[model samples]
Target: MTVRLRPHHLLCLLTYIGKGYSPAFIAGLTEIARRVNAGEEVVIVTGPDDICAPLLEDPDAHCHNPGVQIRDANAARDVGALLDRDIRHGLRMVLTPVLVAQMRAAFANQDTRSACARCDWAALCSDIAADGFVGAILQAQDSTAE
Candidate 1:
């Protein structure tokens, strides 16, 4: 389904991004909410997050809450396969804690350092050079790319 953005969603989105939320998470939640309101069967597959329970309480929803298993999944095998599927079919649903964290941190800090250097998207986001509103700006770029 096509997502129609109103002036307010966009405005609130901008504000949220400025606060360090990840654009992907924002898009994912918006998409899910749209589907839920449209009366579609929305199945949310996500890692654990503080807000997941409340969000899933809405009707017409199902949730798969898996904790972060990024490392356990073995990036090359599991992640690559998931990416391959996503590339061809797009995401089946939206609701992942890792995505949430990414969005939250994206809005909170624009610092270049990744707390540690192992952040996967660091280079793509110039996270190593992030500061001030840099993270939010990068997320905007990410949203367009998506």
Candidate 2:
């Protein structure tokens, strides 16, 4: 059956994945979203726990069973850590190019901005220097250039 997709539904989906739900659970959620979007009453069936609490809080979010999954704390933590590590490692591979480019651009912009703000050629250098030496080499370069 299908249920209409909503903000809370997406939130729960993300929250569940973040909380280290199994691949099966993640696939189930994808089907649920598809069914829901197709206009079926998709009910998420998961054990009760803090992990799924956010979905429970939403009145519209329905579940078959509402109670915590009775796993030992140590087991749960280990599983959570393993899942987190795997997921992050996967993401690092997938996102490395984009993330690296973004970081490079950000660092470059920061360097330029810092030089512009603290360089001797910068209008505010007098004020900045009075406070303390800031990015002095770049400032010196700017002064020599002028």
Query: In TM-score terms, which candidate is top?
Result: 2
What would the per-residue lDDT of candidate 2 be over residues 3-121, giving only the tens digit for each residue? 33221232232112211234544455555534433444322222333224445655754332221222222223332243343221112122122332332233333321221322232
Mark the 10 consecutive residues where model 1 has the least summed lDDT.
5-14
Model 2 Cα shift for residue 106 (angstroms)? 32
The TM-scores of all predictions, comma-separated, are 0.20, 0.22
C-alpha RMSD values across all candidates: 15.9, 22.2
**Cα lDDT listed for each candidate:** 0.32, 0.30
Judge candidate 1 at residue 48 and give its lDDT: 26
**What is the TM-score of candidate 1?**
0.20
| Model 1 residue 67 CA deviation in Å | 11
